[model samples]
Target chain A: DAGITQSPRHKVTETGTPVTLRCHQTENHRYMYWYRQDPGHGLRLIHYSYGVKDTDKGEVSDGYSVSRSKTEDFLLTLESATSSQTSVYFCAISELNTEAFFGQGTRLTVV
Target chain B: QQQVKQSPQSLIVQKGGIPIINCAYENTAFDYFPWYQQFPGKGPALLIAIRPDVSEKKEGRFTISFNKSAKQFSLHIMDSQPGDSATYFCAATHAGKSTFGDGTTLTVKP
Candidate 1:
């Protein structure tokens, strides 16, 4: 509904392998966020970008990295996948500080 | 430290009944509060939101009651339908980043 799309809606990778999730938006929003949802933990922010080339870590940023080179694209990469990292990742976009709209989501599994 | 805390990890209610979810925050700096609803296999979507400046906000059957002094907020769904069965999350935002509660699953049975 927010013109947000996350590539590879579902993915499975073996432990120690590299995995990357991509979030694309058509809204040209200034704020983009990456959040992971797990049972009993709710949705935890992994990383977020305020603008192109401006990104910062979140509560659970360990072992994960993100980059936003353009306003419409934000990328999250798992340098080396781990079983504990398996979870549903959501991408959200917002203009300024208004409420954010989330993408369908990307379900990633590490075995 | 857990910034936001939500209660009643799960709930059940009959159709047409009102369901309330409560959340509390430790950070008084949080000014923006929002409630999100998520169905199975889908990402969470904004159901309703309230700013600290207001005591209550209503959007259709959904309402957000904010208590700044108590550092707490709650969401109430009026005449909840079976379709309203989903997981709900309460979030607090100080800036652009949001801190979320664990989530509450509501089951509305007909």
Candidate 2:
């Protein structure tokens, strides 16, 4: 909520086109994460960055990629947008042991 | 295998009643457990959390029951109100990596 914001809060894109969702934070936390939310599936992690240039894949990493060139910003990109990739995406920031602060989320639609 | 398990995809409760959501984890390595509350068109927010050393933690009308031996935990909402209606998720983490439960949709009727 605080210090966390996601851009393109709502978006509609055509299939096969690339799209990027931006996560910006002022907290300067060490960890940033990207998660996708869907009906009946709750939230699924796509990727997370432990620090600038340090990233790892999550349970649902397929078709999604992330880059955290700066500590305060993390971006989730769809290599090639597909209808299956349409969902609400969340961005989170956190330190080693503290709670994660999540962004409001970006609702994406691909047709 | 799904590491975190939650039950009752959805629940409906009346005001003043208690809504209990259960979660079980397969990884004994998980040391930090937390529950999150999310409203419509919003990001999930942290509600209450518990460490493995403690058996229970209470804050306001929310309580987290931790059974370290059983590797199971639950969230109990006392004096449930209509405003408490939201999607609740249970999560556990180790080394800053987290796994989340499927989530429970609780609708507290007035």
Docking tier of model 1: it is high
Per-residue lDDT over A1-111 for candidate 2, one digit per residue giving the tens place of the 0 to 100 score: 479989989999999999999999998799999999999887888999999999999999999999999999899999999999989999988887568788999999999
Q: True interface contacts reproduced by each model, as a fraction?
A: 0.74, 0.52
Q: Return the TM-score for candidate 2, rounded to 2 decimals.
A: 0.98
Residue ranges of candidate 1 with Cα displaced over 4 Å = none
Docking tier of model 2: it is medium
Across residues A19-56, which tens digit of lDDT does each residue of candidate 1 receive?
A: 99999999988999999999999999999999999999
TM-score of chain A of each: 0.98, 0.97
Q: What lDDT tens digits, residue by residue, belong to model 2 across residues B54-98?
A: 999999999999998889999999999999999999999888788
User: What are the per-residue Cα lDDT tens digits for candidate 1 across B8-48?
Assistant: 89999999999999999998888789899999998888999
Error of 1 at A16 (Å): 0.7
- What's model 1's lDDT at A45? 96
Candidate 2: DockQ?
Answer: 0.73
* Candidates' C-alpha lDDT: 0.94, 0.92
Error in Å for residue A17 of model 2? 0.7
